[model samples]
Target: MTVMELSNLSVTLRRRDVIRDVSLSVGKGEFIGLIGPNGAGKTTLMRAALGLIPFVGNSSLAAMPLAERAMAVAWMPQQREIAWPVTVETLVMLGRTPHVGALASPTDHDRSQVDAAIRWMGLDDMRQRAATRLSGGEQARVLIARALAQDTPFVMADEPVAGLDPAHQISTMQTFARLAEQGKSSLVSLHDLGLAARHCTRLVLMSEGRLIADGCPAHVLTPERLAEVFGISAWYQDTEQGPVCQPLEVIR
Candidate 1:
């Protein structure tokens, strides 16, 4: 089943096109890595798909009624800021807001979901800590847990593992992979090509505000494509751990 679809999607900022003529579909149980160089419109495409910005073209998620869309898709933006000093569990419980009406209180199931999300993200120990006091990587994990607690059919994350250690980064990617196994669809923007190659079931490459390639990691992360889109030469090898890609040098 198609969880999200975008057709001819385009976004303009300050009278300049940021994403143009991009079309993509995210299917159920698929983990897609959205990859590109800085300023390659990865974030623009996601914001457009979520209807967070004004854009042209059709976005299925954007067309849904506000409340319905909230249930269908859970989004974690690139910015991770905890302005309030809420406890970790309290922060994660916010994900249940869509399910619980404005005047309604959370049910037992809501609490259970929140607890499970905390454990899933390996944040059980920090559940009682103040969110603002956590490290950047820990905060990122907590935000991901909040998204997981939403229990949406689709998840969209922009640079979700940006500030994590190598181990945490791999663990975070594995979490998304596990979500796919549970029949959730995810579109994650990532700068780490190796992690993207290892964990994502598919890769969508963008360049200069357009979709350049979309396919399995091996097919999309070719040296030629890397050099063309990322301006780098990469050494790629199929390993028991999965496809590994290391940037050898800049093309220029």
Candidate 2:
């Protein structure tokens, strides 16, 4: 089933088109990695889909009422700076806001959902720690856990794993992959081509505000496309571990 849909989507900011005519669909049990070079409109496209920016297009998620939209898609933006001193669990519990009502307190089900999300992110031990005291990577995971706690049908994240070390990075990607297995959809923008290849069910390659390619990792990360869009040569192959793309060098 299609949980998110966009048709002829375009976004212009300050008289410059940052996201051109692009159409895409995200369905149940799919993990989509939105890959592109910087300034290629990955962020703009996501923001537009979430109705965080003005756009000219049809977006299933963006067209919903604000309250209804919150229940339909969980948004994890690129920013990870947490200045509040709230405990990690308390922070994550915020995800239940949409369901709890503005004047209501969290119910038992809400707490359980937050707990489940915390476990999913391997953050149980840090539940009581102040979010502001954690390292950047840990904070990132906490933020992801908050989104997971939201329990939306679809998730849209921008560069969700930027500050993590290798182990945490793989673990974070695995979290999204697992979500797909549970019949949830996620669209995450990623620069790490290898992780994108290894974990994503599909990839949407963008360049200069338009989609250049869209398919399975093996098909989307083609040598010619990589060299042309990314300006690099990569050695790519499938392993039992998953597909891997190692950059050999920049194209001259």
Candidate 3:
């Protein structure tokens, strides 16, 4: 099933085009990595798809009503600001809000899902701790757990592993891969080309507010594409582990 479909999507902010006419679709069981340089409009495209910002053209996910969309897509933005000093469990429980409703109490199943998410993200030991007190990487895991607890068919995360350690980074990507195996779709924006290449089933490359390439990791992460879009040379090889890419040097 096609979980997400965007056509001619465009987002303009401050009288500037942030996301140009872009079209893409995500199917079930696919893990798509949205990769690009900073300010490449990855986040803007996601926000537009979520209907958080005004944009032109069609976004199937954005067309859904608010409550329905909540259950259909779980989004984790780039910012990890936990304003409330809530317990880790409490924060993660918020993911069940779509199912439980705003004022209603969570059912037993909701609580169980939250617990599962906490365990999945390796936060079981800190479930009772204040989320605000955790380190940045720990908090990122907590936030990811919350998204996982949503248990939606489609998950969208912007730079989900930015602050995580190397182990957690690989683990988190593996978690998404497992979700794909379970027939869920994921669209994640990532800066780590190696991890993206290793885990994502496909990649969508964006540059200067436009979609540049969309294909398998080995196809999209070509040295020519890297030098053209990223202005750098990269050393890439298909290792026993998977495709690996390391930026060699800047072209300039």
Candidate 4:
């Protein structure tokens, strides 16, 4: 099943195209790694798809009513700003608001959801800590756990692993991969080609506001594409540990 679809999507800001004509579909159980250079419009595409920005195109996810969309998809934006001095548990429990209602107290199921999300992000020990007091990387994990607690079928995360430690980064990707196995889909924008290649079931390569390539990890992370789009050379191999890919050097 296609969980999200964007057809001929385009976004303009200041009379310039931030996201040009682009189209893509995210399906059930597929971990889609949205990869591209810094200004490739990956962020704009996700925002436009979520109806958060003005755009010219059709996005099935964007078409849904706001309330319905909130329950259908969970979004973890790149910015990690903890506005409230809430505890880790309180913040994650907020993810259940759509189901529990803002004024209603959490039920057993909501508590369970928050617990699971906290455990997945290795925050069990700090569940009672104030979110604003945590370090940058720890704060990132807390925000991720909040998204996980939402437990939506479709998850869209922008640079979710940006500030995480090496172990947490891999673990976070693994968490998304496990979710995919359970028929959930995740569209994640990542700068770490190695992690994206190893964990994602499919990859979409964006360049200059367009999707330049889409396929399995091997196909999308080809050396030529790396050089052309990323201006770098990378090493890729099929190993017992799985497909390993790393940018070797900036050849351009």
Task: List the global CA lDDT of all models.
Answer: 0.95, 0.94, 0.96, 0.94
* Colliding pairs, model 2: none
Name the 10 consecutive residues with the lowest summed lDDT in model 3: 97-106
Task: List residue ranges in candidate 4 displaced over 4 A.
Answer: none
Pairs clashing in candidate 4?
Answer: none
Give lDDT tens digits, candidate 4, residues 30-119. Answer: 999999999999999999999999999899988999889989999999999999899999999888878887678799999999999999
Q: Global lDDT for candidate 3?
A: 0.96
Model 2 accuracy (lDDT, Cα): 0.94
RMSD of 1: 0.7
lDDT accuracy of residue 48 in candidate 4: 93
Compose the digit string of candidate 1's lDDT tens values, residues 1-252: 999999999998999999999999999999999999999999999998988999999999999999999999999999999999999999999999899989988999999999999998999999999999999999999999999999999999999999999998998899999999999999999999999999999999999999999999999999899999988999998899899999999877
Q: Give the distance in Å from residue 110's predicted Cα in candidate 4 to where it truly belongs.
A: 0.5
Model 1, residue 29: distance off in Å is 0.3
Distance from true location, Cα of 85 in model 3, Å: 1.4
The order of the candidates by lDDT, greatest first, is 3, 1, 2, 4
Per-residue accuracy of model 3 over 124-159 as CA lDDT, tens digit each = 999999999999999999999999999999999999
Residue pairs with backbone overlap in model 3: none
Give model 2 RMSD, 1 decimal. Answer: 0.8
> All candidates: CA RMSD in angstroms?
0.7, 0.8, 0.9, 0.8
How much is 222 displaced in model 4, in angstroms? 0.9
Greater-lDDT candidate between 1 and 4? 1
Candidate 3 vs. true structure, TM-score: 0.98
